[model samples]
Target: MELKEYMNFVFPGLILKPSLYYQWDTRIHFELAKGLYQFKSEIDELNDEYFNRVYDQTTTLFNEIFSHNDELFLVTNVYKHKGDIKRNKKIKVYNHYINNKNIRFQLKEETLPYMFDDDDADEYYTSQFSLKCQKQDIRYPVLLKAICNQDFPPLRPRFNNRGISNYPDLFFINIKKNIIFYIYDDRGCEVIASDIEAIRPIYEKYNEWIDEYCREDTEQLFK
Candidate 1:
């Protein structure tokens, strides 16, 4: 199963968002899962347990996926609420590259617009992970990097300051086909993350598909 199908299996009744204003290049969306209604009744250790378990499960799944392939990497921007919402740790694991071999993962921190003309500090943000496939020539991720010396309209600049944030570059080369995968959490981190089990077989299948068709250049793309 692909992204859409896996989303349904992990957390059903959620759909992708068409567009969002004042947001980054996030073209993804979703809502809370119907299960785990117990949290609604009462918020206690169970809530914390649920969140931790879900996060651990997700991270483990991704760890497995990345471990299996030398050409894939995981970039996680962990957010912590310590009097203020701050990025606790920015991790780039396994492989972080734009060459033909690897695909970099990304998840942007987004905020909701309130009545006031300011980014709401109180509003909890959602999580959306993306996989951007690009050529080796591109120096930076597409979301922040300029294409042909021109930026995509209304650029959501990352500054890429300190090299802390790493995303996929959008600069494509005609030699091979490049793509992006936006798996979103529309519930604003309300529930759990994605299903690795559902994604494994399909992801393997996708690689097989690419191997069968996009030939020769595949090795150059990875290492």
Candidate 2:
């Protein structure tokens, strides 16, 4: 089915904010299966049983859809949280039988937002602001790198001063078609399919439909 048709059926009756205001950072929360918890505490604190369970289940889910021919990657943001904590939020990416599992755990400094400044505080603040503004645009390259790395952590963190957060958990790239599928967690497993051509029609149609059905304020947010 066409993307719009799918959205109409899936998103209709459901209340979803427009793509702009929709917080990409929340994807990890939505994707975690029921009863499985991803701790917000330090990674070192994560128990091996919980980690293995999550990993095994996640990998199983991914492997079901993606294969070797299809490139899979994780996408997420690196956020410097309060208390000087650096956390990596995981998201899941799968396409055509190739599951790029736990790709967010493997991200490096170069793949995340970076800042150039003498003042450490200023750099962190600036990077955070920039990341919020340009996250959608920067998402592609990070996902590409994740796929290329075979979903493994790079040697050493990419940089020393900056910390990362809200990293993407999953990405699927159809190399032959040059299409990128960003599968995020929202309410359920929400998939955002973006190809210059494939998604434009859906966006246009969604805009048109919103114009007919949504309030002006709501429309403004969604558009």
Candidate 3:
């Protein structure tokens, strides 16, 4: 599907909002599921072992939730979330890499009038790549880790300021599956799917590691 068409399905009416907003949208919506990772210390992020596990589980979830041959779009804002144009050093480098790879992207300026005032629309230098469910491709894990830790290049795993790793936002989407997975600040993640059965099993499979608040929020959402 064209990017416009796919995006319309995900964020109907050109309403660019977070997964939380989509969960409540009646026109195009999904069953909400949440997961959390156990941290050893308040100052610590996911250790190597659990980090790899999260990557593994996430990739597995992607593969299982959608068909092997289905088209998947790994979409995210490449913008560094800073105002000073000169300070966009990291995403600038990453943007160069993206251009070299010939990824399809667009520059978006979105404003939520109801939530905010003063015409301060957030600008997003968004990049969207068509992907598949193959585990052999190194892109899946690397990008997933980047989204998790918010690291650019995503090659070496590490945290940024206050452990708030990487970019403005990131999303995993499959139009056919009617699902969108959103990860935030390496903290946790939530998936919204129209068909509850599509994600229920995976959530249950990782229940022990899933954050209780996430679980409760999802439960409350559907109830």
TM, every model: 0.25, 0.29, 0.57
The residue-by-residue lDDT of candidate 3 on 55-167, one tens digit each, is: 76666655665565555554544333234453333333234223224332332323222222225435323332333222222255555665666543343543333211234
**RMSD of each candidate relative to the true structure:** 17.1, 14.0, 6.7
By the TM-score metric, which is better: model 1 or model 2? 2
The sequence of per-residue lDDT tens digits that candidate 1 reaches over residues 122-166 is: 442223233433223223333222221121223333223233222
Q: What does the lDDT come to for candidate 1?
A: 0.28
Query: Of models 1 and 3, which has the larger lDDT?
Result: 3
True-structure RMSD for candidate 3: 6.7
Q: Candidate 2 lDDT, tens digit per residue, 64-168?
A: 334444543222333353344434322222221122334333333322333223345333421111011112222343333343233224311112223432343
Q: Give the TM-score of candidate 2.
A: 0.29
- If the candidates were sorted by their lDDT against the true structure, best first, what order would they fall in? 3, 2, 1
lDDT per model, in order? 0.28, 0.32, 0.47
2 or 3, greater by TM-score = 3
Q: Candidate 2: lDDT of 94?
A: 25
Task: Point out where model 1 deviates above 4 Å.
Answer: 1-34, 37-40, 43-46, 73-223
